[model samples]
Target: MTLTFIQNIGGGFLIIMLLFSLIYFLLWVYCVIDVIRSNFKDQNMKLIWIVILLFAHIIGPLVYLVLGKNTKVGY
Candidate 1:
C-alpha cells in the first residue's frame, strides 16, 4: 500500500515537471519572437538582444520584460 502511494506521488511530480517545462518553453519562444519583431533603429541591437535571450535562459525573458523598452515619450 505504501509503495503504491509513493508511485502515485512520483507520477504526479513528473506531470508537474512536464507542465512547468512546457510553460517555460512557451515563455522562451514568446520572448524570442517579440525580440525579433521589436522596433529598434540599430539592427545590431536586435541581434544582441536575441543572443542574450538565447543564452541567458530563464533570466533572459525576465530581463527583457523589465528593461527592453524604449523609455522616450513624445514631447
Candidate 2:
C-alpha cells in the first residue's frame, strides 16, 4: 500500500512539472511574436528589445512588453 502511494505521488508531481514547462514555453513564444508584431517606429529599438527578451528570460520579456515603444503617428 505504501509503495503504491509513493508511486502515485511521484507520477502526479511529474505531470504537474510537465504542464508547467509547457506553459512557460508557450509564454516565451508568445512574447517573442508579440514583440515582432508590435509597431515600433524604430526598427533598431524593436530588435534590441527582442534580443534582450530572448537572452534575459521571463523578467526580461515582461519588462520589454510593458515598457517598449509603440507606434508613433505623425500628422
User: Which candidate number would show the highest lDDT if scored against the true structure?
Assistant: 1
In terms of TM-score, the best-performing candidate is 1
Considering only N, C-alpha and C atoms within 3 Å, which residue pairs clash in candidate 1? none
Q: What local lDDT score does residue 31 receive in model 1, on the 0 to 100 scale?
A: 79
- Model 1: lDDT equals 0.78
Model 1 over residues 1-39: C-alpha lDDT tens digits?
988876778777989989999998898898788877777
TM-score, model 1 to reference: 0.73
TM-score of each: 0.73, 0.64
Clashes of 2: 0
Task: Judge candidate 2 against the unseen true structure and give its global Cα lDDT, from 0 to 1.
Answer: 0.72
> Taking the tens digit of each residue's C-alpha lDDT, what string does model 2 give over 1-75?
988876778777988989988987887788788777776676677788778887888687567656664432231
